[model samples]
Target chain A: MKKFLWYFSVTLLAIIFMFPFVWMLLTALKEPGTALVLSLPKKLTLYNFKKVLFEFGFSRFFLNSLIVALSSATVSTLFASLAAFAFAKKSFFMKEYLFWLFIASMMVPGLLYVIPQFLIVYKLGWINTYWGMIVPHLANVFGLFLITQFMRQVPDSLLESARIDGASEFKIWWRIMVPLAFPIVATVFLLNFQFHWSNFLWQLIVAQSEEMYTVPVGLAMFKSAHEEAYTLEMAASSVSIVPISLLFIFAQRYFIEGITQGAVKG
Target chain B: MKKGVRDNINAYSFILPFAFIYMVFLFLPFIYSIYLSFNQVTDFSDVFGGLSFVGLKNYLFLFRDKEFWWALVVTLYYALIIIPLNIVVSLLLAILLRKRYRLNSMYRTFFFLPFVLDAFVVGIVWTFIYAGRYGLLVNILKPLIGGIYETGFLGNAKTVMPSVALAMTLKGAGFGMILYIAALDGIPKEVYEAAELDGATGLKKLWYITLPLIQPVTTFMVIIGIIGALSAFAEFYAMTGGGPIVYKWGTPLGMTKVTGLYLFNHFSNLRLGLAAATSFVLLVLALGLSITYSKIQRKR
Candidate 1:
């Protein structure tokens, strides 16, 4: 009986939480008129999906978001790990001060930097270019911080032994730290990818060319194009979510782990 | 001195990428924005040389602007309403799910689903749900619930901000829930077991033990929540176009507009200096709140 009630409440909460996604799915499948109303689809069809995917150049936007997200994720992770190794393993005069400054930057709201970042990009003549979108994000503070914490856990003796054998710090970082830090690397990649993919404001600002727009910008434009085309819009929304949802489902354990790692300590 | 300097050079080499990119892209831009904010320039084509000093007029004028104040109020109101509600709801959900049951992971994923979703997608999806005339509520729940059929929740001046707030709450609650769950997991089981032996159960144990122990995480979440609310632009842009009826909402748009959107608007309008000024103000506000929060957290 206790177990039964537990299951019942869990199910109810799950429904409350998952209702919007389900509603989106149902809306995507229903006819336009039916979607506007609260009724369930009498019969599901692929028409809305076909319209959004084939007719609307959503495929190009998806590819753009994917390319930008992946490029930024990969490059940022590498840069963060390299910097984190120095902070973790090296002893220098200004190490503490530099690390603190890096961490301080993380506390600032991202939007705070968006304007300056835009101006900088414009000055460099990198606006609407992939480099403008990807470069600023490549030196992520949170990623560096996460990796630094993780690196600090690895015993100094291992690195010392490699050093004694005439291996450079860079070699030790490349060979030993990178391999051992796989879990965190994956964690950082997934988290960063998710954030970059979902980021809209910067994309909307920098991506002036239609060909350069990410999925979110494209979807926003699509929605505005046909305010009354509710089913098609919902279908576009669903399509946009599918990739990120799948990515999250696969790596949720690590994603949640990475988030909590810092939350608890602070 | 030579050997020590060599080590410094090596260490700096490792950190070179961070310093170079962050300096060029972030720090330099930040400084430039401050410079831009103090200037007035009419033409974008002459950005570097054309700017003339404007003093505190931009800020003084900002204080007098009604739209700016409204945006500030609405932003704060959304933060005040949603942050506490989110913290409370997430804590309750975390505690409720503390006991082991089947499909707990599924429940966790369900809650987290909306957050991973694109904000534009959430905005679009909820727009339909909150539609005035032909929304799902009217067609399905209106007859039974009986009063929601007449109003467009997102279109109304009174309801637009709150309606958007609730959507943000729903999309955001899962993240808070995840953080709470992590804190809950870290609490030693024996602490709860001890509380149970003292005849304390349910909300009593939660009130006495759980709340105080999780205060750090709660504080962190609240700080982040306020910053998130203050900086909110994407959802407002996607859902409300920054206005239902143009009453201030306490968002960053009050002084600067969304730097991103402002830049887009003025990219062709030749008003780069004004846009840059707006950006600088937003950055300062964000940094000010973050510094205050950090100090408070440290003192605690």
Candidate 2:
């Protein structure tokens, strides 16, 4: 039946789509030295993940990633929301010009900024420091831009009422704008969180010490350094894969919408 | 009407905190990079000491740098393949899933799952898949074609970029599929019903209705894809480390060293002048292509 064919095709595609993740689990569970030819786990063990955690310092890397990603996403969202409030609701001279300048600056590829920024950071003695990992990226223009777009839809009458109630701009932003824009900001926060979680290049450059490496950079370093240790490497990546998959499952709706909005508007 | 000074002060206060830091990290770099491109600094400390103006020496040097040209070619090849392939694959998947069906959301989530994983994580996963002698892909294909994929595609110089490109396309299609699905859902059902009433067949509806309606989304995806291809780094670092050198016109070239890695190499060596120039050139190329593409689209 045509109906049967439809379900069959979709189910097949879904399985194929999930094949790598399934393989990742299988590979992670396999005993060390298990042949790649063995599609199924042979005497499944957490030995590989344990090796990565204990020997390769994956726990340290995960903690570092969590600290950096959590702080950066939260701080960046706070700053961006404040700025977005001003842009959306306030009357300021040269505001349009200045905002355009900010947006236009984004057109210059981020690669162009790395060298100079690194030089400046080095001059300031921030290299190999957590400040190196966190501060330089806190003002992501995309986050500001996304929050601004969401804030503009916030009814001006609501803000006017707050003003009439003698609420200060900061208080209004905290009390009213915060609640009103909470949904979008939450979405953007998670997006930024995932983004920082996956940040490999910046983390790679900044982390001179193995102790400082974030999850992505640590996973990468683990791979190249322990080249033949396929099972261990698979386990290391599974660390990232598991959390992200869980994130996708729990926040799938926001991610689906947030990612799409960031795409089309961005 | 006379504007109040209070509004201006309040606005500046709110904006300056971010604007100042953003300028220090972002805007200042934009200008300094251009200046750095014209000056030589051999060490990171020397960058603080002073920059010796060399005019366009770095640019001239880059012009003759075979590695840079090869990187440019590799980038172009990636864009040429990835841009179209990503858009088409995602678009086809979107069209297939356009109709409301059982487990549609599950299907979409599965498709979009790979995109949620970081590029480096995905790269590691693919490296396992491409692990020459001990690869899932190799194991699966070995029975059909004996030893052809014995070592795996990533290790082979000729196949490395293509191999990376294939992995990237597979992971990347999910992102664009979400974009297309959203775009498709936005198209009014009345429009389709009207088309059906007009005797517009399936192919006709797709060509005249779906394609044209989603043209803007397509353009946006292409521009983003082009920039992505040009600036590809994390995955390459994780997957290839920009290695498995091939002899391109007798020059030892990294088969997968796209522009991003090329710049990273320069940065690591403290060749700030060259790195700055390369970034400038790439910035221009990216912005130029984006402008040109948009202009072309506007004209049409």
Candidate 3:
């Protein structure tokens, strides 16, 4: 009886948690102007998806988001890894002070940087461009912290052996440190990817033109513009969510590890 | 000494790329924002060209602005509700799911799935769920209850903030759950066995042994929750657009206009100095809470 009660509650909570996504998919499949009901649609169709992707120009937004998220994630991860390797492995002047300064900056609220960052980006003629969407965020202090933490645990002897082989510092980082730290590096990559994928406010501010809007900004604009079109709106929402959901499903381990490690250790 | 010098050169070369970007983007902007807060810029196109020294005028104006005060209240209200709801729900779920079950991983996945979603996406979906007449929740509850939910949760002034808080809590609870679960797993089996040897049973064990052990995670959650509440913008922007205006003291104010949204609105309207001032207020609040958090941690 106790086991039965436990199973019942867990299943109930799961259903409650999943209901919104299920409702979204069902609504997207339903025809436009249909009554909003709890029951599943009698006839499922892809018309709404097609309309959102093709007619509403969500495909363009999708591509833009892909470019920005992928580029930002890859670049940030690479930069963070290089910097983390130096901090973790090398001897340098003011190294501890420099790293602590980076960590301290993380405590300052990100909101404080937005206005000034916008001005800087605008001055550099990056507004309405991919650089505007991606450049300002590449510093990624949290990513640096995560990678540095992981790299410190890497055996120094391995790097020392490589150095004995006359491998330069750049090659040691590229060929030795990065491959050995692949797990944490991947975690940072996925975290950064997810951040840029759903990054709404910064993208909304920087991408002034409709043409440059990423998925989150585009979907927001789409919803406000097409408020009454519930079916199409659900389709747009699903389009924005599904790819990332699929990524999460496949890379569940990294995502979970990254989130837990990021919070717990910090 | 020579090798140490070479090490410094090698390290600087590696660190230079990230350092340069950090200096240009983050460090410079931080200083510039503090400067901009004290100066008024009249032109969007030419921010520097139109600058005038306003000293403390912007900060003084925020102190006198009713909307600013209301935004702060709404932000506090949001934190008050969301922090507890998130902590309780996530803690409960973590304790329950801590041990293995028939479908434990599936249950974990279902709960954590929403965390992967963008806040904007969750907001839009919940907006539909809370829509009047045609909303899913309204339709489900109408036959069982009444038409009281016709305007739905987001449509009314009184219910809007709580409704937004509920939606955000549900979306974010998964994150806290993961943290709590990890912390729970870290507790030794001996701790529970010792508690059971004492007169402690289920709830008593949870209160005496479990909660105390998980206090650090709870503290972490609260600090993160406070910061999240202060900086919360996307959900409000998506769900309420910071509105469903309510009249108080003969002045119209947005029912859900938290500080982050207020800052965004000001920045959007080209009120640069005021927006910077609002951000500074948020920054100070966040830093103050963090300091208090660290102080408490140290005391414990």
Off by over 4 Å in 1: A31-34, B143-148, B196-198, B246-300
User: What is candidate 1's DockQ?
Assistant: 0.66
Interface RMSD of each: 2.1, 1.6, 1.2
Give stretches of model 3 more than 4 Å off: A35-38, B143-147, B297-300
Give a tens-digit lDDT track for model 3, residues B1-300: 897888788889888889999999999988888888999987766986789999999999999999999999989998999999999999978977976878898899889989989999999999989887878777767876354467787878877888898888788888999999999999999988987888799999888899889898998888988899999999998999988888985799998899988999899988888899889888899879877986888698
State the TM-score for model 2: 0.96
Compare candidates 1 and 3 on DockQ and give the better one.
3
Best by TM-score: 3
By DockQ, who's the top model here? 3
Each prediction's DockQ against the real complex: 0.66, 0.71, 0.80
CA error at residue B12 for candidate 1, angstroms: 2.2
Q: If you assessed candidate 1 against the hidden native complex, which CAPRI class would it receive? A: medium
What are the TM-scores, per candidate, against the unseen true structure?
Answer: 0.91, 0.96, 0.97
Candidate 1 residue lDDT tens string, B37-114: 677775557566677888876666656765555556566677777788888778877877787786788888888778
TM-score chain B for all models: 0.83, 0.93, 0.95
Query: Which portions of model 2 miss their true places by more than 4 Å?
Result: A35-37, B1-3, B143-147
Model 3: DockQ vs. true structure: 0.80
Cα DockQ of the candidate 2 complex: 0.71
